[model samples]
Target: MSAAATTSQPRRPRSGNRRDEAARLAVLHAADDLLVEHGFGALTVEAIARRAGVAKQTIYRWWPSKVEILLDTLIEDSAKRIPVPADEPTAESVRGYLRGFARFLTRDPAGKVLLALLAEAQHDPDTARSLHERCLAPRRARERAMLTGATDAGEIAPTLGPDATMDALLGPIVYRALTGASIPRGLVDTLVDALLRPRAN
Candidate 1:
């Protein structure tokens, strides 16, 4: 009833969300380890909780579904290791960065994991949308910015727009991964050559 009384009430102690956060993180980490060892098809919600040292109720309380857990795991792992530079003065640096991205995709579990997730995303609208927003767009934007800077600096031809340049540069890698084709012997060199080639226009 009084201001002092209200102040002394201490706001009724705001409930901490730490338990939810802990559960969510535990699920993601469990998903990563399970997916790496047993593949997506073999992973289960209960198995994840067992591996994570948490309860099944905790995972469900936070994620609602196994797919959501996998998506969160992918996002957390990718965020920590995407090799895009904090600073690069030219398109070449961008190209090198993308090559590193490819290396990450191809090495260890990250590559196979991403491919599986991408395939799953194709059938799930929510997953697809989140993948595009959280993964593809930011990486593409970084590459585009670097290329645009290089073009402005006369390192690359001015006719090359961001999207087209990115396609010319990255399309090959995507083709390789998606189709299971070998990375062309001179992948980066070939892309750079195509990128730096004079536009007939």
Candidate 2:
């Protein structure tokens, strides 16, 4: 097209996806700074905006509330992705992968953010659904594959339920996190061992 013709054409609007993503990142960074300085109880949206140097309306334009911004911040700051395994999926490999993931959550900055987000998720259904879609479901499916694969390999009882096994494996880590107990690494190892180790029937 001629430069004249190009100039005459109506300009397309900025990409909403890119703009929204930039806005989201800004809010998340703001939230992270506030959280580190003041902790969860005092990390308000107004505080986040002040730190981000954006107006509160700008933050709200991308996120509905302070909790939503915090959830996204946790996810972005996490070193690992939803399907968190670090290697190919043998049952043993999968067990090892998840243990490493759990340990990271306990020891890393992102882990603290995830714990904070989980506490918020208890009272917020929107955050709960987003967490399920963004984090929980993908990891659940990966673990499910490892559990169900054992049956196909004739290692586990085909009669056994994959869903039940997944619940058995995941339930304890979450339980310990919620219950305010010091979880032994041994407990997680035990759960993995019971689920993935070959059982003689």
Number of clashing residue pairs in every model? 0, 0
Provide the lDDT at 44 for model 1. Answer: 92
Estimate the TM-score of every prediction.
Answer: 0.73, 0.71
Quick one: how many clashes does candidate 1 have? 0
Candidate 2: segments with Cα more than 4 A from true spot: 1-26, 36-39, 78-82, 86-88, 150-160
Model 1, residue 36: distance off in Å is 2.9
- Candidate 1 error regions (>4 Å): 1-26, 181-185, 196-201
Candidate 1 lDDT tens digits, 91-115: 5666676676666566645565677
Which TM-score value belongs to model 1? 0.73
Model 2: lDDT equals 0.65
Model 1, position 115: C-alpha lDDT score: 71
- Candidate 1 whole-model C-alpha lDDT, 0 to 1: 0.68
